[model samples]
Target: MRALTGTGVLTRLALRRDRLRLPLWVVGLAALFASIGNSISGLYETDAARLENAQVRADNVVTRAFTGPAPGSSTGALTVSEGLVFTCVLVALMNILLVVRHTRQNEELGRTELVGSAAVGRHAQLTAALLVAGLANVLLIVLSTLALIGMGLPAGGSALAGLALGTVGLAFAGLTAVAAQLTESARAATGLGGLVLATTFLLRAAGDAFGNTASDDITVNPAWPSWISPLGWGQQLRPYGESRVWPLALLLLCSALSVLLAVRLSVHRDVGTGMLPARRGAVRASSAMLKPIGLVWRLQRGLVLGWMVGIAVFGAVFGGIGDQVDDLFSSEKSAQFVRDLGGEGDLVNAYFAGMMGLLAVVVSGFTVQALIRLRSDEENGPTEAVLATSVSRAHWLLAHTLIALLGTALVLAVLGLSTGLAYGAVSNDLTAALGDLLETTLAQLAPTAVLAGFALAAFGLLPRLAATVTWAAFAVCLVIGQFGTLLNLPDGLLDISPYSHLPNMPAESLTVMPIVVMVVLAGALTAVGVAGFRRRSLALGG
Candidate 1:
């Protein structure tokens, strides 16, 4: 039989397996892009007004650093370009993780071995995985194009924009394929792919921030640094401006090259082994691994440290941008808008509070992930072995739960301290600002605890569906908190978010009732989860 025998059969089976997931990804991504296009079109109805607003907002260094350089002559095009660039990056990341998981990870788990024995050729599995990812990317392109054109964007420009978005996904899918071949563990492959994604974003951000001119002069053009990054190339296509199609070709060529490299690597590697062999660890367990809690800490320390660092950096950047808000508020109309957003509080403080709220949501996601780790361990059968030892069920549950609670608190505190210090330095009020920011950060603990409690409860009541339920709850909360104002959702609907009950910190005085209620809810849920876990048979798989 040929190396690629049964490739078509495997491809069909993989498609059947991922029927729902791939379509959801494609539809969600396209909808998000289209929504942004619709919002921009509505907001910037006049070309002259758009141009003026773009000149100001796009020129701001912090804005430029966050979003890529401005797109076309009109403001509407610039807004669409900025929003699409980041959305495309997110879509690409989703694709990379999904594709890598199914390809290399499935094989490593021995599922592919069963298939290979059943008349499947060596290359058939890889072919099927790549085909699934490719088809999903194509759907993304088509859906995005239709959504944009439906929203009244020029059809040709809309198609180019969607193609740009899909090109990023295709490129990253290829990169992930190569990464999957290089790493023995699925986690390591995902991490390496994430690192590549982050580096690309940072490089694109740097290029956009430093490479562009803010002035109105027609003679000067932005630097060519954006041309080097794949994301930059997408923006350079200038979806609405002279709309160049060659960048998509460039992305396609790069993707083809990456695929060739991945196939070549796969040809030499063993079924379960990586191109880079796994390193040997010390034969004995570390002193830190002796206790259940200690082992939990050790296992989770790297993830917590990464979260803390990310939160700190995010805080610092947001705080640093606080100094610019006053300058931005030079317009009385904008100043009034800021005031309305935050009542009578200091504008910068309000912005800081809002930033903290957003960070709280992110920290809550970490907390949920940490708590869900217990459910994963139990379902994987490792919990059975650990429970058979001296460790009681409560001890095991507590070890993970405490980590989630304490780790989230530490992350939030560090974020508040970092932001306060940065903002204080710029505003020349270090002591007071630090105190206020820290207070606000602590206030967020209540709502975050509520989120953690929900995750724990879900794990307890529905061990099989815990992860999905936990994330879905969090997603609902996030939507209510972030978009409630813009969408004009009713107060009752918005009130479902725990953060809604907590007084806006730094801007408003702290209250004890909401905090107490949150703590009680979290405690009750955790207790129930532990009780349920003790009674139920440990689940092995979905």
Candidate 2:
């Protein structure tokens, strides 16, 4: 009990700090779940439509890899099968980030140490972080259930689905708590948590994709691999199918173990430090390392490599699956349905084009992260150190800015190359497949540039709130680009996103006008950011 002292105050503090951010995550996820549920429900109202949907998914390795388990012959199961994995991912992300922010970020900022110096107990901060994370997951449960039920999904299934997702989320929260204790830097903590999330996701995906398909149309069985993952455990609950409670028990047990381990580790480690020691740097910096671009590269190299590997893996999977898409939709009716959904003339071309559109948003995340490093540097005192020398503010800022631009291009190009290579291998027309994928990939860079420019501009102008502003813009763009059509949002609203303006390549004629416009917008915003940084003093904190 003594170790948990002041947990309430710190918990409230976490809530206060995350007030706006927390709500946005909750509402955004709820909206996404509700929207997907509604769309699935409305699209397939009859038994025939539902079975057809299930059959297509059951046969498609790509769908199984991403979504997991074909739905049983019921509306609720269909909704669960379509939306469960993605929604669970979102919930896990929310919990992990929330825990890391309150724990490792506070320590990185020295707040944890300061609080610990007072009447606060050794475990208070971790306890508070866990408490806040638990509360958020509970809220997710309530909101998700209500949203699904409001969309006319069966109440029992909806509630079970919500509980399953929430359990997965809380489990990851506990994992993140342990990660926070293990890593000194918040970025490292978040990265560690992300790595776990990726591992579990892959485990679950591999199990689902390679798992047994029974003779009966209704049952898709996952093997032992899926049983090894927390996500897989949650999925095994099978909200609208089996509705098992035992898996939830396993998830909760894992969460409890993770939390207990974190608490024990906390007692052994010093405040503001990690259980695992950080590595020591070289005594002298190399000439190449001293250069601004090189320095920025060193800082961002880990992230770039991670993205490259992830994209390459994803590209291979997507490309491998692209070949099966045509065969899966062999029926003329299925072909027409895909074409209608894609709004493209050729089914294969349209599929590739739609994929490029989604990849654009993904690459934007990399772009934004790269650009935000400037804000991070400024806050951490590195910018001031660099600027105090012969380097001018504009030059130093532009050095990093240039890297962000070039890095975005590099990431996109790599994605294009890998995607084209794998896709061409299977598509059989190597040249045309490579050419089309590369062309679409390059065209999508316009929107990615726009996102980087926005982050850079926000960093320059709203130094303190740069992260908030940029992330909000990113979220809006993501929602508009991904869901605008389904939601039937206004053209004006959709037009606000740079992605909306890009020509749907391979499906439609390539339009140079929009690309040029997006590039100019990106350039102009970057200039604004440079000017803002030049005029303002560095906002470093003690």
Candidate 3:
């Protein structure tokens, strides 16, 4: 009872802090789910059409890897099939960020100290964070279920689908709770949780991709690896297909265990510290760590390396799957759909082009991460210390911005090169694969630069709102670029995303004009941002 003291007040405080942000998340996800069903209904009017789509999914390892098992039943199930993997990833991210923000992030910022100075118990903060996260998952279930049913999906299936998503979020929420207790830094906590999530996603993808290979018939039989992933268990619920509920018990068990462990760990740890020991750095500073660029590199090198490794792994997996694209779709509908999106080119090239496009969006995230470090440094007083030295504020800001741009380019290149090498090894066209894949991947840099530039500008012009607005902008572009066509969003609106303007290289002609324009635009925005930052006072919060 003492451990639960002030839980109600703290939960209310967490909810208040996230009022606007939480609504956007719940609404955005519900909208995405609703859009999938709504759009698919029109695109797939007949059961035959849905069955054909499901057949392609069941047959194509690449499709199955990207999505999951095709329900092969009703259109609702088909919709769930197409969107489930992405939905699970998003839900997991939402919970991780939410839990870490309330728990570790609060401690990092010293807000937890102020709260704990009151009548609050030691475990109150952790309990409140879990409660807030739990409520968010519940809201996600309620809203998403209603959205699905409102789209005229089977109520039972919709409810199960929402429950599946919610339970996954809950599991991650619990995992993140443990992560917060295990790390002294919020970023480290987030990174650890993300690693777990990435592993689970890859496991799920691997299971689905290689799932049916053992059988002669191209039927859906996810491998044993799938059983180990929470996502896999959730997918096995088969929302509209088998409509199983037993697998959800695994999620419940895992979540319960995770939360229990986190609670136990919280009991052992001191406030403002973690169960994991912090690494000690050298007392002496190297010459390389003295300069602003060098210092920025030192601070950001780990983050960049982490992203590069993740991108490289993703690239290898994507490239290895290229062979599966050859005549993978026999149906005219599936082939034409690929053709329409990929241009009149080799199917494998089209697949690579789409993958590179996705990688482009992903690299933009890296860019944002690198650029946002400037804000963190500012808030934490490091920037002021650096500026007090020989370095000018503009130079300090510009150095990080440059790192963001160049680091992202390097990461993208690695992705392209890794994908090229892997795909070439499998396809036996090493030289051509290397050149084409590199070109396609580099072509995405223009849009990625635009996103980074925009984030920098937001940082300069609106310091307080920089993080929120920049991420929202990225989200908007991501939705527009990725799902605009599927959602039937207007062409004029879709054109707003810089990704929409980039040439779909390898599949189509690599035009120079649009890319050139985007680059120039990015430069202009960066210049404007730097100038604005020079004029603005520092935004430092304790």
Candidate 4:
């Protein structure tokens, strides 16, 4: 009983800590979903048009792979098909980061030890973390439901859809709790949880993509693989089609069981340790640690390699889809939707341009994460030690920043090259496909640079607020660039994001002037950040 005695107190404390962070995530997700729903509603205004869209989706393997089957014949069903999986993914990520931040991350940072010195029980922290995650998911469900209902969707289906998203998040929250027990470091715990998420997501995608058609222009009956994953269970709910509620039971069961396992595992390990033994490192430091950039790379290479592989894989899959979707734009309404999301000119070209633009935003997430390493190193007490050597403050800061910049190019290049290869092979014209995609992806560099520079500015001028600023700025850019037009968000608010100036390539002709201006702005921001960081002490903010 004493083990959870402080859970109430800790829960409040956790809420206080995450007030800003969690609200931002919840609002952004719900608004983005609603914006997308509004766009889908506009795109398929007529019953005939909706029917045509459904038929196109049913025939499109790529759409099925990404979104699964439409749950029903209505616009709401179409919205669910388009947004539910993406919503699930974002919610799961939210829970994973939430739980891990309160549990393993706090432990690694020694906050747990300070708490344990008081009257808190062994299980109190984990319990509080899970409670906070549940509350966040609940908020998401309610806001999302209201958002759907506001768009004139049926209340019952809208609530069910929200429930599906929330339950998936809860299941992953519980899973991540177990992962926190299994790993010694926050990064390790997060990586373990991410592996599980990635595996299950792929299974769900494969199952849906390869499933049997339940009826023409309607649901796809997923295979057995879908039944094994929490995300898959969410998809099986058929909220707008069958309106089934039993699938939620599976997700709830998974969450309950995983939580029990985590609580049991808590008794077996000491605070700051893990159920899995930590691997011992070598006695001597590597020569790579001698230089700032090399040390930065050593810390960042795994993250870089992971993004590169993921972007490359997705690029190839979508490139193949791009080739197949050329005929899918015959309908004027479909062309209009594509233009709204993608760009103008040829529909297929617009699709490619849209994909590249989104990928660039995705890569900027990597950029923000990479830039925030400055805060992590400083917090973990390594920056002082490294800078104690000959490494100047600017040298240390720029080393990490340069890797983030260069790493962007490497990832973009991999995405371009892989997509080009796939598209060319499918289209039987390697030369032109390779050239166009390579150039299109390269054009994204200016936007990516602008984002990186912004994040770097956060690191420089606001040492204590780097991660928060970086992530917030990037999130704003992503939501605006991806969904602002669809939602009809004001041009002023939309233009505040760097990606607004990003040229949607191939669909719109290239302009050197905008590219050059973006480059100049990025350089100016980067210089400001480096100069500010140089002026401050290692212990400046705190």
Candidate 5:
């Protein structure tokens, strides 16, 4: 308690700094859950539709691996079964960033050192960050619960779902607190946390996939692997089934232990350092170091590689799940399920088209991150140093922008190839799958470029607001473009997303005009951003 002085003040500070960003994340996630609930409810309106759809998915190993068990046969249960893993992943991400931002980033920028001049305890900042993250999760739980209840889901189940999701967030926040103690660099800290998250996800996936199902076929009791993962504990709660409280104890207990470990470790390091020493750069520069693009790549290459690997895995999973429609159309009732998803007569084409849209949206996150790196560099000490020399702001911005655009296209290519390979293996048409998905993914480059341009424009014109604005835009676009139709949103609203302009490939004839227009639009927006950035003075530390 004596070592926790100024924790309350730091908590308020963290909250104030993140006021806008935190609410956006919470509300956006709640809305996303509501949309998913509404869409699943609408799609499986009847008992027969729900039951048959469940049966179709029950035996599919791919579906089981991805979605885990259906806790019950109801719409809300189906939503949890399909949505729990994905939603928890997002929640975990939100918390990891929160912890890393408040702890490691502050230290990296020397803010912690500045704060330490006061009577603040060594553990105060980490503790305050965790508290703020806990509060955010509380808001998420409340908002999401209300959203579900508003959608006419059961109050108990809704609360249970929200609680389970919140617990996973807290657990990850605790884990990230520990990661922040291990690494000197914020990026490396994030990567360490992500590696743990991925490991837990794989454990949960394996447990659920190999779980023992009841005679009902829909109900599953996951294997021993799930018991250790916080993610798996969320599912084990069975919000739609038993609504167990025991798993909450597991989550809380693990999180408490992790937090204690982090607190003890905090005493072992100085304010500006970590348990692990920071990496020292090489003494000599290479030829590639002279080029701006190469330098940008060197900084962002880890991010690019991570996205590529993630996209590849997801692409394979999504693509391999493609031809499994044979099992899905078990009866007349289940076939109507396909029609409800707005599929044409050819289910495969519709599935692939939908997945392409999702892939584009996912890959675009990396694009925004790459572009925002320029602003971050500016906010830190590097931009001024580089600009003091002969390097123009235009050249600096161009290198970042080009990498964002090109890296996005490259990742999209990996997505397409991986999907094509897995889908081709399953469908027995390797040439056709490769050719079609490659074209479909490439067609998305124009739309992704449009998003990159917007992010760059925001960075140039609104340096302080660049990160907030682009992430907000990304969230809005995701909700609107991804689930706008399911939510019965207007076409006018949906069309605001750049992804809306993507061609309906494989599902319909190629609409090259939209792609061409988007490309032109992206170029114009890129010019505006570059021009604005050139005229503006550096607003460092704003």
Candidate 6:
């Protein structure tokens, strides 16, 4: 009871604080579902054509791996399944981020301390954060239901899909709450939650892929695996099939149990302490940690290594799928589409080029995150403390910035090398594929540099809103780079993404002009950021 007092008022405050952000999340999710529905309906308007396409797609291992089981016969069912699986995962991600942000992150920043001193109880804060996340899930359900129904899906099936998606979110919200209790730092909590989400997604992918195989006539019931993963349970609901709704009840039960566990953990631990004890570091600094640059490397090394490994894995998987793409495009219709999207050339090279572009986007995200870390450290007052020593502001900023740039490039190269190695193994053309991959990786440098420069400039000029501005820029770039073609956006609008200027590699000749221009822009932005940072007063902790 002491833990649950003043929950109502705190819940209201949380709601008010998240007014804009919550709505954006809900609307974005709704739009994603709606867009998917609309796209599917438009693509497969005829039942006969839809059935044929579904069968063909179901047999395609790559398609199956990406999008779970194809709907058996009905066009509507197929559309629903495709949208439900992807949207449910997206919703789960949203819930985890929201819950962790409001709970663990708030505590880490000392915001909870201010409220704790008031009439608010310990459990009240946790309860309020969970309530906020739960309410957002409810909104997600309602909006998704409306969007699906508006798409002309069966009312019951649509509602089931919405419930399933929301349930996945609720389940993860609980998981994040527990993680928040276990970890001392918000970063650790968020990272652990992300890892769980990734694991769930992989489990679901593997289950779905295994179940759909031809030799598996015994029907490897995906329901069992789906039960193993909260994400899997969402997919197992099979919205358009039987519309089983009890799985959602299971999710709710799991969520409640998780919340109870978190509460218990909270009660046991001291304020700002974690369930897992922190290990002490060595008393003396290592030789590698002596210099400022080395210190930066020490701080960022884990993240950099993680990103490299992840990108490399992605590259390998994508490369493995390349051969399958060639087989799929053997059909004239698919081949024509591929050619139109990625000029007439060796299909493998064209596909690889497009994949490399996506890799560049991911690498850009790394660059942005790395650059923004500097601003975060500065605003947190660590930068000021560091600068009070013998280090100059220019040296500190440049050291971090150079690391970001070089780190991103290294990640890109790793991706290229891993992908090339996999593709070469399949094609038995090691030299050519490796060369092509290296060239494509190099081509991405222009855009990566531009994004890094922009992030640094924002951090330097608008120290207060640097992180927000940088992320917003990255989001815009992501949209332009990914959805521009699908949305039929004009070239002028697409050109806003720096990557738009870099010619598609492996399929197109290398163009030095755009590369040179990007380099100049990067230099200019870096100079501006450095100048602004030099002039501005050093920021202190909030």
Best by lDDT: 4
Which ten-residue region of model 1 has the weakest summed lDDT?
A: 214-223
Which runs of model 4 end up more than 4 angstroms from their true locations?
215-217, 282-284, 324-330, 482-495
Q: Per-residue CA lDDT of candidate 6, range 356-408, in tens?
A: 88778878888888888997787653687789899898889998988888798
Summarize candidate 1's per-residue lDDT along 92-160 as a digit string, tens digits. 777787777677778767887778787777777777778888888888889999988887778888888
Across residues 1-542, which tens digit of lDDT does each residue of candidate 4 receive? 99998999999999999989899899888887887788788767787777666677767776777777787768888888888888898899999999999999999999999999999999999999999999999999999999999999889988999999899999999999999999999999988888898888888988887888765756688888888989899988777677889999999999999999999999998889999998898899899888999989988998999899889878987787776664645567767767887787788788888888888888888888888888778868579899888888888878988898889889999989998898888889889888888888888888888988887787788988888778878878887887788668999988887777766777877888878988998999999888888877665652
Candidate 1 residues lying further than 4 Å off, grouped into runs, are 42-48, 73-75, 214-225, 326-346, 540-542
Clashing pairs in 2: none
204 in model 4: Cα distance from truth in Å?
0.4
Q: Rate the local accuracy (lDDT) of all candidates.
A: 0.76, 0.82, 0.84, 0.85, 0.84, 0.78
Instruction: Quote the positional error of residue 527 for candidate 3 in Å.
Output: 1.7
Instruction: Give residue 513's lDDT in candidate 6 (0 to 100).
Output: 94
Q: TM-scores for all candidates? A: 0.91, 0.94, 0.91, 0.95, 0.94, 0.91
lDDT of 5 by residue, 37-138 (tens): 886786677887777667656666678777777787888888887788888988999999999999999999899999999999878899899999999999
Question: What is the overall TM-score of model 2 with all chains considered together?
Answer: 0.94
lDDT by residue (tens digit), candidate 3, 464-537: 88888888878877778866765579999989899999766788879999999999999998888888888888
* Highest TM-score model number: 4
By lDDT, the better pick of 3 and 5 is 5
Candidate 3 lDDT (Cα, 0 to 1): 0.84
Rank list by lDDT: 4, 5, 3, 2, 6, 1
On residues 1-542, what C-alpha lDDT tens digit does candidate 2 reach at each position?
Answer: 88888989999998999899888888878778777777666666677867776776777666787787655857778777778888888889999889998999989999887888888878888888888888888888899999888887788888888898889999999999999989989999999999999999999998888877777565578867788899998888887777777889989999999999998888888878899899898998878777888888888888888888888776777776787776645556656545544556878777777777787688888888888878878877488788888888788878887887777777777777888888888778778877877778888888888887888788888888888889888888887876676567988998888988877777887889988888899899989888888878788311
Error of 5 at 27 (Å): 2.2
